[model samples]
Target chain A: MTDRRTIYLDNSATTQVHPEVIDTIQPYLSEKYGNPSSIYHKGREAKEAVEDARKKVADLINAEPEEIIFTGSGTEGNNMALKGIAFANKNRGKHIITTKIEHKSILNSAGWLERNGFDVTYLNVDENGTIDIEQLKKEIRSDTILVSVMFANNEVGTIQPIEEIKDILKNKNIYLHTDAVQTAGKFDLDVKELGIDLLTLSGHKMHATKGIGALYIKKGTKIEPFLHGGGQERNLRSGTENVPEIVGMGKAAEIAKKDLEKNRIHLKKLEKKLKEDIFRKIPELILNGHPEKRLPGNLNISFKYIEGESVVLMLDEKDICVSTGSACTSNSLKPSYVLTAMKKDPVFMHGSIRFSIGAFNTEEDIDTITKTLPEIIKSLRAISPLYNKD
Target chain B: MYSKKVMDHFKNPRNTGEIEDADGIGEVGNPICGDIMKITIKVKDDRIEDIKFKTFGCAAAIATSSMITEIAKGKTLEEAKEISKKDVSCALDGLPPIKEHCSNLASEGLRKAIDDYLMKKKD
Candidate 1:
């Protein structure tokens, strides 16, 4: 399995770290290793590198450098944004609004807040996985202090209406936070233009190494600190900085911003070709997510009457990496909540496969998937008791 | 995660496809739960002459289905019914703990096939 040519299509899960990012972070891990909080020359160098990375990450999302707070991962960023705000604004209100299709980080954070006596309203999504603006209007309350939604869905690739939701919350006192973990490098994240107050980003999703993420908090936003350690990240998240991973993320963010257009085009081309080829080859398949307003690199489809985990395993044998929303693949034995929120049938949810392309994927990779997937589906469907050939 | 024997059985499933004149047919599980096993048996002289399975599931389910067919093919109807879910799993070395329920489908389908054969004998 290790010797075969690996075709990695699970980019949305996490991307392969870019070679440039690796090179940029090399010195920080070795000779330049110094605590950012120290007063020595080495410390100053580390501090400068950390600030530079912050500026780069901020620039990627069009936010001020002072607004970015580094955390352990995107999950941490989301926890900081949700719990931090919920606690900081407890005097103002205890009400929070979020969509049902948000990533588990946001949803689970909101759930924690609810358990801690905050009121949370989970808005439902339409069939295409977009939240309803009219429903948001109805759900808004005077005490609603925050409305957190994801920029895009990770499982199905459905991009949400962040700008529209921002527009609705503009005049209101409620702050808006968008979890952009899936959208950071793939789309233009203009926080200012979108009127977003807070946003979450993960490094690994954008070709940087894991274990580093950033949260952009607009100036003057009331948010409690995540950690109460030695003051770092403006005391929002306190701890010794992960210098190398931060530096790598900065380089990754810079590269992502610079090559956004080219990467988008390349990814879209691969996605379109793969979608067309797979649809042509396989019948009785339903493409999940919004058909047009989806991520450029995401292609989620459900092969009817077959379980997704089986297809994933069969594809693995061919050295093709993919993820499935099937219950059998999950620890809790429940299919994807994202798909369930979209009101997809249980059968479709069990059969869903997400093939997320990346900057590294090529037309040949797409061709291999299109060629291999149909045969896998055919074999699995042949054994499926529910599949009836017409 | 599957054992090597489980992978082998999944890759080369024994006695797959429908028997044209299967004396007894049994289906367990459903598409909603993501694992379904259908077993067909040819019974003669109170023994299973042939047994086949078709499954819609993950690796464990298919492997267990294949394993049950191999375990019960030449056994008497009562002996086949005695073959438990654990027996199917043991034949395949072992299944992931999370996938232990998958083996239940194979044993249940086999027992149902026996019951179906007995029901038809009365008719």
Candidate 2:
């Protein structure tokens, strides 16, 4: 280590665990390692810790503790919600509705449901990544039993109209599930007010350790258990509890609830300064996602005539970590499907870079990025044959 | 993931620029696929005396381009054309499986430069 500070702006991928959360989880790891399901005194202590963590998570989301089910990760929570709901309510209906821009967890689970004889209606989004409410209402058929949408997009940070979607489905028999993994700790989440019956959240995205997540199922929502064994978590998910991580997640959630507004304001300021500096210095830059409706910390932009992967590598050299929409970083050889869905041109898709800020970011960090980013883009664009100096 | 040699070349790419007085030039890839390379060669006496490349691609693509130029310089046109995709990738130690396609751009760029040379000679 050269004692150089690393600027990590990839919060959408995962966040660094907070020290407070680490302190909260210390006792649970070594001293209180007993399983929550056991009946002994140690087990009782573990169970109390798990319940307390659950209560904290519930309080953050404004839900009953009974409504939350702990899972292995956000992906698992999404799978449980989509597959469990699809299987449990198959008799009542076989159709589902979701947007084209949901996280892969929900989309892949929806694909699995399709293979099992369920019809899924994928609603399209506009240029800003907001789904069409009129189209969503038109697509809901008599056989539609569930509607799934994301609270906010992970790639572009475009927030969906969760409250509007839920209100539209209020009178219907359909159940509404929103994957709130990206939006959970960043904003206020009242399930009743949002009209969301089911929601998913990941620990690592909100300053907690990985491998621990939760799904909120409102009372009266019918869902079958995806995993069957040991009958833990209301028989919905069965596994030995991850005590330390759960405690960490609970602590993270509590801190997030208290610091949501402050973090939001801080990130917004960082984003504004970074964007203004970048736009002033660089030309042919296009911003992605909804302007005002996006996450406070997200700053996605496309630098034309240069590859995003190249920009990412160059930025990495400076110890500033960021992610891109380039196919080189992704499994597929095509540009980001989220950007593609927004009808972005191929050049913009290939050149898109996402700077997902977080609570830890400071104005000086923004200055460091703005100071280094323009030169990186300028140098790459200089060598880019497609770019014209004019 | 990349090999140490790939990282080395990516960190310090050689012969990167446009030879405005070059005898031949070849460009491959488009912005759509997210990788593009333009090679400019200064050939003299049927020998590639100088070669430069400008690439807009991933770490692998840029490294492979740099490696191709290093392999092509001071070689006869026929010898430079014979440089294979495996040769460029092997020069960089090796590329990840997903990035193997980037090497094709490297060799193709050299061959295209040679082709451009022959075509302009015929004209």
Count clashes in each candidate, considering only residues at least 3 apart in sequence or on different chains. 0, 0
lDDT of 1 by residue, A202-266 (tens): 99999999899999999999999968988888888888999999999999999999999999999
Q: Candidate 1 at residue A334, lDDT? A: 70
Docking class of 2: medium
Model 2 chain A weakest 10-residue run by lDDT: A325-334
Residue ranges of candidate 2 with Cα displaced over 4 Å: A1-4, A326-329
Candidate 1 — what's its lDDT?
0.89
Task: Give DockQ for candidates 1 onward, in order.
Answer: 0.77, 0.69
Q: Scored by CA lDDT, what does every candidate get?
A: 0.89, 0.89
Q: TM-score for the first chain of model 2?
A: 0.97
Give candidate 2's error at residue A122 in angstroms: 1.4
